[model samples]
Target chain A: MTWETVIGLETHVELATRTKIFCSCTTEFGSPPNTHCCPVCTGMPGALPVLNRRVLEFAVKAGLALNCSITRHSGFDRKNYFYPDLPKAYQISQLYLPIARNGRVDVRTQAGDKTIRIHELHMEEDAGKLAHDPATGLTRVDCNRCGVPLIEIVTQPDFRTAEEVTAYLEALKETLQYLGVSDCKMQEGSLRCDVNLSVRPAGSGELGTRTEMKNLGSFRAVARAIKYEAARQIQLIEGGGRVVQETRRWDEDRNASLPMRVKENAQDYRYFPEPDIPPIRLSEEYLDALRAAQPELAQAKRARYQREYGLPEYDCRMITSHRALARFFEALVELGVPPKQGANWIMGEVLGALSQRAMEPGDMKLTPPTLARLIALVGEGRLNRNTAVKVFEAVFDRDGDVDAYVRAHGLEQVNDDALVREACAEVLAVNPRSAADYRSGKEKAFGFLVGQVMRELKGRANPQRVNAILKELLMQ
Target chain B: MNITPELVERIADLSRLELGQEEVLETAAQLEQIAACMDILNRLDTRGIQPMSHVFPVENVLREDTVLPSQDRAELLACAPASDGETFLVPRAVE
Candidate 1:
């Protein structure tokens, strides 16, 4: 019997809001433990939580970008659970009425374009971090991340393969990044995903017993977990055993999943509406404002890049993957650089430099104007491509002055006619046989004379000017 | 949604409650009464009534995005059962 895998994702993205969702505490990451906490965020007795306006705006913006219908009436609920990280013992979430629902995102899979439906999106507060000290055998809780705003986007079980899930995730990440809702940094735990997977016969209409895996941190881990879990379930069924519905933890090191809890052991969350905060009722005017505020998403930007800038589809996709890179490209084009040149430089040199230094586009100190200036210098015959590349590296690495570095190193192209003439004269004197051969209609010898002139000028002489000057001197 | 002794025991375990034999019996009886009451409420035929999540008519209750300084570490951690200046210390959690 052929088994087909069915998968859905519940992704939690920490909003980029300046403050916590229900408190005035800063939402900055990597602060000293417990420093960003307040009475409200720490869940102190009698401390009330007031919703942060930015959280709602960001959530609505994300919903709009994802093609979700924003619910006019939504509210928060309390999911009661006992855990060390959750000091309140109840996480404020939305259950009865989520803020948005019925959204769809089109993702490119091996089977071609597939539309994945978003079940709902809700706002929630983040719990604290628990750090276990192996040496001391003690657990410490850091509440600095507590109360950080997050939006949980739940998708329907529309995926059949790992590739589809990954494509959906990538598309979702790009959309959120373009919307500026979240950093979507999986490494930093800014975006977390839990995948629910099951396997059934290929033509089976009903889903098989599903297992939920918590905290598959990276996309690769999600794909691997789905593949491993599906195989395990299929093998079990093939061996005359039934797949148990349970929650499992993906052991990244072991590259397998271990059962955490079964359905019988599942904790009943005992959800109830939170009375501290009122229901959220958004007006049509507010919805319109958010819709207008929505920026060009990655797909729209890709199409625009193709239509307006005449960029290739592949180039458009690569350039628009990161909002920062897309902005950098646009800035360069706006600074009078040709779109294709800007795309080539960014896709080649800029991306190469970032990868070489193990840096993100957001960490790049070289501004777009500075890069545009460098490209302009190269285009105006002031600097050869090689020297311009060196200048770009220096500027990118140290954030140094590009023009100053070029001037200090004398890396400018020697396009001066007199200087080229002098260099050509020296090369001709040194390579008399090559010059004689060039005058005698040996076209290949002309290239040798040009190379000699370039070497005499220490590669500073422009190749085009050198060719022209060498031919003129040889003809004379 | 039948309430059984086993179901009650599971709920107690999840809630981290240790119930004596008599206490479990009494709690089960009381839960049965509550379930009967919920059954009566469920039997009502208010077909068009909208499900309300909150009592108030207000929505979009939000505060401005501003940073307010948190309480001092000493003051806040003082309420904890155990703390070491920087973090709240708890019994070691085993995975």
Candidate 2:
């Protein structure tokens, strides 16, 4: 029997707020352990929680960008659980009424563009991180990330393949970055994903037992987990065995999923409205203001880039996929550089540098004005394309002065007519056989002579000028 | 709704409470009484009454984004059952 994979994603994105969701503790990452914690965040008794207004604003901004409907009346609920990371024994989340619902993200798949329906978006507090040491068999808890603001975006099961899931995540991350809501950095855990995958007969309307894979650290791991889990379920069904519903952890090293534990029944979270914090009442004016403040998202930016800059659809999508890259490209164009040239440099060189270093676009420190000047040097024949690329790489790493680098390196193209003529004449005198071959209608020998002149000029000769000068001297 | 012993056991398991068999039966009876009271309350004619999540009339209670210094870390760790001078030590967590 043929089986089809069904998937949904629940992504947790930490907000870029200055303070924690319900306390004044700083939400910075990678501080000394427990340095950013306080009585409120650490779950000390008699310490009350006061909501951060910035958290609400960010949640609404994200909702608006994701095409979600913001709820007028939403409140927090206490999801009761016991874990070492959650000191309070309960996490403040939303159950009955979340901040936003009924949103959709449009992702491009192999079939076509499909809209993945968002189930809900809720504001919640983040739990601390538990780092386990295998040698000591101990787990260390870091509470610096505790009580940080997070918005969990849950989507309906709309993915049929790993590609769709990845596309949806890419689109979601781009939208979040464009909105300035979150960094969406998967490596730093600013964004985390949990995938719910199930398999069913191809023509069956019934969905099979779905298992959740928790806290996939990277996109590659997400894709691999989905493929392995889908195959595992399909094989189980074919073998006349049943797939047990449970939580699984993706082992990146083993490249397989291991079941964590099997639950005979679902664990009830015992959710109740949080009594400490008041209900969130959003006004119409507040939502409208947030919508007005919303910047152009990735989709609109892609359309505008195609229409205005006349860039190819692929180039537009690639450049606009990351907000930082798009901003760099625009800054170059605003500096009077040609749009196509800016797009080419960003798509080719800038992206190549990022991938080579295993870095993101945000890690790039190269300024657009500096890059614009470098491009102009190439256009003005002061620096050839090869030398321009080298200058670009140097500036990209050090953020140094582009003009100073070119001058110090003596990379200026040899455009002097007399100099090029002397170099060409010297090459002809040494290579008499080549000159005779050119005279005897061996066209390939002429190209070899031009190469000799270029080598003699140290690759600084204006190639087109060198070609013209070599033809004139050879004909004579 | 009838509160069964099996339901009570499941809830005790979720709450991380190791309830004895006698205690499970006793808790089920008590829960049944509570549920009967809730059923009586549910029978009232309150169609027009707005459901309130809190008794207080306040909404949007918030504070400025400023951080205050926390209490002494050594004192805070003293309250835990186990500590490593910097963090609360617990049985190793398995996922």
Candidate 3:
């Protein structure tokens, strides 16, 4: 029997604010252990937490981007749990009134474009880091990451296959990057996700007993774990064994998951309103300013790239996938480069060069005006496509002068029609057999003559002009 | 409301409190009395009243997002029960 998987995600994004959520400690990652903590973040007794203003602003902007309605009045809650990573044995979170709610995002899937509904986005404090030493069997607790500002975005169970789950995540990551709130680097732990998945008969209305998988490090791991868990549940059901609700740890090495905590052992984080932190009330004017400051997101730019520049859907998607690449494309357009030509350069030559060197588009130092001048040179027949490509490689990273390189190398095309015709005549006279072959309907002979003609001109001749001149001489 | 033995046992377990049978009974009586005392406020007719999460009528007392120097690491780690100069050492636990 076919089974369907239902999935939802709770994604925690560490805000890119300068300080911690409740304290003034720097939120920088990779500091020495326990070095960035203060009395408030380390949860010293009687040390009260004062909410950071930037954290609230970042959360509101995130809510606006995701189409979530900002909760004008939201308060904090204490999620009580006793873990060594949590110094105070409680996490400051939100439950009664979250920062935002009822948002939706559109993601592209193999099936089609699907919309994932966001349940709520709430601001919270991150817990400390725990590094287990296998040798000593002791866990090292680092409080440096403690109290970092995070927004936990919870999504409705709108995902089906693992593809949709990852698609939604990619779309979400892109959106967050566009929002400029979080770095959204999964490797750096700036963005973390917990998946809640259940399986059921293909047409069943009731969901099977679900399992929680915490922190499947990468997107690939998330997909693999989802597939593995769904199969495990199906096999259990078919074997007359019931699936138990539990938190499972995904072993990336084993390619399977092992149960970590059963229902009975799971800590019930008894939540209550935090009395120390006052409820936040955002005024309409404050929200309007944030809205005004919001940049044009990747999705909107993708649409605009298609509508305004007449770019294809594929081209628009590729160019606007990253903000920097899209900006480059737009700058080229503003500099009088044809939109289609700019799109071509980005998707073809520009992206190709970066990938060849194992670099990101952001690392590219090639300015748009420089590229525009190079393209204009080709349009004016001063430099052919081959010479232009050679010039591009030399100046890609250093942002060296493209025109100077062409001039120094004498790589400019032979634009003089008289010079091209004389070279064609000389090649035909020297290779009469090939010219005879061309006159007798051998097109290969005509190509050979053109090659000779380009050689006679020291390869500076425009290939198109050479071909046209050689074909005329052969017909004669 | 009657506080059942099972409910008392669960609450004691959550708090990690160990108690004898007589102590459990005593704790249950005290908890019931506490609940009853709060029920006194339930008798008041306060319809359409917004529930207050905090006692004080204050909101949005927020601080700017700037990095203030952290307390000296050695000083902070010295207060912990155990530390290895850099991190607090906990008996190896993963959950």
Candidate 4:
């Protein structure tokens, strides 16, 4: 009996806005306890929330970017709850009419590209943080995060594997970042995911009971949580135990999930339209303008990189994973470096440096002109490949002038054929036994002579020229 | 609407409120009547209409990257019920 895992995600991304969604307080992270709060955000009596105009524009931009249908009329609803993090008791969320719906995002995985259907995206205010004192058993609530703007992007239950889920998340994050809607910083709690997972018998028409995993902060955590939860559910079903629908939290240190609470359905929240704010009506002209503002998304950019730059499928996918890297690649091409060469250096050197530091390519201090110069130098043979690596390392120190650096360090390629020929002849003359071995049909002697010449040239001799001279000397 | 004793107890537990026997019976009847009035929302055909998440059509709210002023620590601490000059003081809370 085969089992299949079904997963959907509700991702919340804190918008990279400056102030709280409804108040004039700063939205900066790590402020003094309750310092960012104001009368409106703190829900003081008689204080009113004025909608931030920038929040709406950002939401519309995100809707257009994700290929969603912007509703001509949408408004806020009150989600009633009694959590201590929300001082207002009832959170102002969109339930009756969301800002956008029916969007689609394409994610590439090992199985191939899959289009994940987006259920909807809505704007809402974030709650505060609860700091629990383990020693004293007291919980303190910090309301600094209250009223911070957030967009909850919900997806349909379309994913089957952990890899596909990660691919979809990566694509979604890249889309949101490229749209300039949110920073999507998983470490800073800017982006978070709640995964709902269930497993059913292969070819079963009915959906199994699913468990929801909350507060998955990292992409890896989300994947691991889904994998563990799916296996747990399948084993329970096989063991003749019922899989209860509940909410679980992923403990990263233990690498396991523990039950948190019973999951609540929509009926539990008792949602009603918010009376504090008015309904939003987006005009057709406004929608058109928003649609026009969206830049080329990941899929379009990846396809264009393949067709326009003649990059391989893998290179195009890697280079276009982040919009910043894609832009850097284009900038290098604009600097007149060949497309293939630009792709190779960025995918190899730039990514190599980033991974070494556990950083993103955009975090690299190396500018486009600096990378372009290094590639051009290697392409033109002014700096040999081995010496170019040294120059690239020097880029971290804010140095430029690849040619000058190589010249000052005497790292120029000894590509002169006569010089290589002389060195190869000297090696053949000294290692007479090897030369004799070559004359007696020992093909290995050819590599011995090539190494000798490269060592004599201090690794600056071109390999192609060394091979040619070694063959020429050995044949003689 | 006839309120069940069992339903009344469940609602009391869920709301995390300790309810007396007489208060529970009255609260259950009131809730059932309210639910009867709210049930009309289930009949509306909402096939194509999107759920509203926010009221105002606002977007792209941003703040400048400049560091701004902050409140004095002593002034902020004045609002706490118990304080030790530098930190908020509370009752012995943990094991």
Candidate 5:
């Protein structure tokens, strides 16, 4: 019998705040253990937690972008648990009044367009890092990552397949990156996802027992776990067994789901309103300012690029896929570079350079102004496309002086009328066979003569000018 | 309100606290007294009065996003019960 799977994702996105949620500790990653910790983050006695303003602003911005209704009055609650990584016995999170609710995003997959409904997005602090010693089996705790702000985006079980789940995740990642809310790097532990999956007989209206799968480090793992768990549940039910509602872990090594523990009920946490931090009340004016300040998202930018700049659909999609690339393209246009020409350079030269050097668009040191100058140099015939590409490669890494590099290399195309005319005259005199063949109307011979003229000028003369001068001299 | 031994044991278990027999009896009495006092406060129901969630009237007390130097690693790690000069070494943990 065919079975259908239902899935919900709880995505925890670490905000790109400069400081921790409750304290002034730096949120920079890869710091030594206990270095980026303070009394508030380490859960010292009598220490009070103060909410970060940027965290609230980012949450509101994310909510608006996701088509969610923002909660004007939101407060924090304590999720009481006894985990070793949790410095405090309870985690400060929002439950009763989350920052946003009832949001939705349109995700596209091979199946079709599906709307994923967002249940709620709440703000909270991250737990500390823990590692177990291989020799001693002792768990080591590092408070450096404690108090890093995160927004847990809980979605409704609107997904029917793993494809939809991954598509939604990719779309969500793009939107979050575009919003500048979070970097959404799965490898960096900045973005973590847990999948809740259940399987039932096809055409069944009743829901089946679901299991929560954790430790999905990547999208591939999420998809794999969903399929494995769904099949596992379906197989159990078909064999006269039952699906247990529990917390399961996605073991990437074993490629299977293992029961972690009995499901931790909400009542187990004993959630109560946090007495330290006050309820955050947002004014309409505050939200208005935030909405007004929202940058153009990928979809809007793609449309604008097509309408305003008349760029090709493929080019618009490629350039606006990343926010930094879009910003750079806009900067280039603002520097008086033609849109299509800039797009070509970015798609061809810039992208080639990035891949060859293993660099991200943002990591490239080549400034827009410098690239525009290179384009201008090519447009003016001072530098041919060939030589300008070399110049780009040279300066793309160090952002070196473009003009100085061009001058030092003597890469300036031969633009002198006299020099090109003389070079054409010599080439014509030397290649009389080709010149005679050209006079006999052999089109390829003409190209041969032009190559000769270019070689005569040491491969620096403009080929168009060389061809023009050669034709003029050949006519004689 | 009746506070049973089972109730005290469950609460202590949730909090990861170990209680002896006499200590459990003593803690049950204290918790019962505290819960009874809260019951007294909960009984006062006035019409048209909003439930108070926080004692402070202020809202949106937040700090700006700025990076400041964290507490010294040596100092902060010193607060731990056992540290090897880098991280806190807890007993072998499960998961």
Candidate 6:
């Protein structure tokens, strides 16, 4: 019998604000430890947190983009916990009343489109980073992240597979990034996910014991951990052993999860409404303005690209997967390259380079104009598609002028059809046997002739023109 | 809402605390009382009430991609309980 996996996620997105949530300290990452900390974040005596207005605006924008009903009244609560990372013994978080709820995100899985229900998205302060010293046997806590604003988007256990979980995360990240709530950079720790997964026998009504995987820093890791954990749980249960409820850490090196600690129940938090901070009353006008500021999210953008750009579903999905890449596509189109071709190149060469370097489109140094010029070269037939790829690589290397790169490399396309026919005729003269084969209905000879023409033109020949010239020469 | 001894131990475990027995019993009682008081929120019809996440609304607040100069090593090490010239020192770590 097949076992079904149940997956939920608690995604912590560090807001891309310049300052801390409750204090004016810089929300910068990778600084010297404790440098960004102040009296309020460090929980010194008599230091009161004055909430940053940007934090609230970002949260409302997030709520609106997530399709959540923005709360008119919400307040912070004190989640009582004693950990070294938390400078304040009790973290100021929302529990009894969260910011937004009942939102759903549509993710594309193999089973087709599935909507995952968002339980709630709550605002809270981040704890410090525990930088463990390997040489010295101590875990040092860096309080720089303390009091940094975070929106914890908790999802219901609506996903049934690792692929679905990944799709959901990709959709969520795109929405958050588009809304400008967070950088959504998993590598930079701006956006991170914790997956809760459990497995049960097929057709079982009762939920199985779940193991929570914490702080998966990448979408790939989340998918792998869920898949690994689901199989492990199923194997344990099928072997007549009970599945244990625990918190596991994914060791990417080992490609397996190890037990960190047992899972904690909700009552363990002892959550209480914070007395220091009062209830926040959001005005209708304020929410309306925030709604207006919310840009088209990834799904909506993908649909629009499919409809407006007349791109295939694959191209639309690839282009809209990254907001920066999608924006670049539109910018290139504005610069006169056709939308479909722009989408294709961005999906093909641009995404390929980024993936090879394990980088995001935002990390690209090549500007939209430079990419537009490259796309235009291909469109005008001044650079063959293959040569355009070389030009793209050159542009990436030097961040140089595209026109200069084309001129320096002598990489103009062989669009002179008469010249291409001459090269095809030479192939016909040299390879008389292949020419005879073509006359005898050997279709493979056509491919050989096209290759010979491309090789002769140093890949500068337009492939379609070469194919047409080869067909004409062979027929003669 | 009544925090029993069992509840206190469980919460201490969740909080990763090494509390004394007397403290556990006392804290559990306090937690129970607090939980009961907070339960008052349940009675109020919040069926359609939107939960607030933050108090203010600000957008597109970004910092420039600039790196400013920082303090010397000595200044930062002053905050550390123990430190070497370029790194913070601590007990010997295993693996």
Measured over the true interface residues after superposition, the C-alpha RMSD of each candidate is 1.5, 1.9, 1.5, 6.2, 1.7, 7.1
Model 2 chain A worst lDDT window (10 residues): A260-269
Clashes of each: 0, 0, 0, 28, 0, 8
Runs with alpha carbons beyond 4 Å of true place in candidate 5? A261-267, A416-459, A465-476, B1-4, B21-51
lDDT assessment of candidate 4 = 0.80
Error at A436, model 5, angstroms: 9.5
Tell me the docking grade of candidate 2: medium
C-alpha DockQ for predicted model 6: 0.15
Worst 10 residues of 3 chain A by lDDT: A261-270
Lowest lDDT sum, 10 consecutive residues, model 5 chain B, at: B44-53
Better of 2 and 5 by lDDT: 5
What order do candidates take by TM-score, descending?
2, 1, 3, 5, 4, 6
Candidate 6 lDDT over A253-312, as tens digits, reads 788999975435643667877766767778888887877777877778778888888888
Model 2 per-residue lDDT at A387: 73
lDDT tens digits by residue: candidate 1, A41-159: 78899999999999999999998888999999888999988777878888999998899999999999768998999999999999999988786788998899889999999999999
For each candidate in turn, the TM-score is 0.92, 0.93, 0.91, 0.83, 0.90, 0.78
True contacts kept of 1: 0.77
- The candidate, 4 or 5, that scores higher on DockQ is 5
Q: Candidate 3: where are CA atoms >4 Å away?
A: A262-265, A418-439, A445-460, B1-29, B45-47
Q: How far is candidate 6 from the true structure (C-alpha RMSD, Å)?
A: 5.7
lDDT per residue as tens, model 5, A162-207: 9999999988888999989999989899999999988888899988
RMSD of 3: 2.8
Is model 4 an incorrect, acceptable, medium or high docking prediction? incorrect
Which wins on DockQ, candidate 2 or candidate 4? 2
